[model samples]
Target: MNTLTINQKNKKNAARIAAFALLIMTIFAGLAFGMIHSNLIVMSDPALTLENLMSQSSKFTIEILAWIVIALMDFVVAVAFFYFFKTTNPQLAKLSAALRILYTLFLSVGIYHLIQIAINLDHTVLSTDIMIHLRSFDVLWSRGLIIFGLHLIVTSLLMFQTYKIPKILSALMLIAGLCYFTVHALYWIAPSIETTTQSIENLLALPMTIGELSFGIWLLVRGSRKPFLNATERFGFNA
Candidate 1:
């Protein structure tokens, strides 16, 4: 094969690897956020929350394990996206990777609260303190989402400028990022508007879910099908 053919093959392989990473990220995140954590932890009721954690300590531990898996997969996804899109704009790709890593760091720290809850579950004397810590998880996660939203916005902009991904996917990502930022910002800025913010969040869930899931599936299915010879051409730059 000629040099051009060799390079094309390498690009295709890279795209495939990145796509697989995204798929793994999606699966792990779904299990962590949707299945394990959401089911096991009751955010509103302190007594019920403690009882569940204490009664289902093993399951709680499994949830934490799932979260750790999610964190590891998130790092993989960040690196994969950086590698895949670095040709379009290296600086923006680096920024995107950095923001994602920062969000992961925040989530890693936040997991400590969950771990503490598991450890203190058997100690009835620590019940009150544990409840306070449980509430902290919600706050910490919201703050982490703020950073995650910024990462998504940057990633979406990069996608928009590149020919590898669809423009509609980029638009979806932008909408999801805006939803995350707006909802969380409202939650923090005006505690009195909790009901209003929650209603907005429920509406925002549709775009966020569709955007992220569709993007992941696209990456898994079609990411390696075509390679752009001139990545910056779509953005009006010389190859």
Candidate 2:
């Protein structure tokens, strides 16, 4: 086989790996955010939230483990995307990967705070400090998501510039990136408008979910092969 064929093979493999990682990420995040953390948190009352957290050390530990898996899988997805798109636009692809990896690093810091809470769960600690650590996770992750938005924007630009992915997919990805950027920016920029920011995010949630998840699904089915096959079918090119 020629070098092009070998590279294509590698790209296909990367797509599959990235697709699988995204799926796993969704599952773990759902369990952590939707079920575990949600049950332990009371968004309106930090003291109550702290009480719930202390009540369930074992479950909280599971949530922490889930988050750790999420972080590692995120790194895998970032590397996989880098490999998958590097040939399309080398510089932008590299920047995209780097941005995501940096976001993952920020996420790691948030997870570290959770670890601190877990380690000191049994100790008699000030409620205020515990609440601060809990809030730190939210603050830090929100900051990381701002960076995550940029990563999506860069990736979407690469998608638009290439025919390997559909134009609609690119548009959705761009919208999702904008959603993340806008919502998170409001979070820190205009704290008093928390409700408004949430509303905007809710309105834009569909695009964001469809954007990233649909592309991941596409990759799983035939993301790389379709482009190469299109060349074979329409252009009568030999592989």
Please name the candidate that would achieve the greatest lDDT relative to the true structure.
2
lDDT of 1 by residue, 1-239 (tens): 75445545655676667667667767766777687777766667667777777777888888788778878877877887777666668899899999989988888888888888777678554557876776787788888888888888998898898775788999998898888878888888999999999999988888866776677778767867776444545444443
> In candidate 1, where is summed lDDT lowest over 10 consecutive residues?
230-239
Candidate 2 residue 48 C-alpha distance from true site, Å:
1.5
The total number of steric clashes, by the backbone 3 Å criterion, in model 1 comes to 0
- The candidate 2 region of ten consecutive residues with least summed lDDT is 228-237
lDDT of 2 by residue, 129-166 (tens): 77788789999999999999999999899778655678
Candidate 1: lDDT of 198? 91
Model 1, residue 138: displacement in angstroms?
A: 1.5
- The clash count of every prediction, one per candidate, is 0, 0
Clashing pairs in 2: none
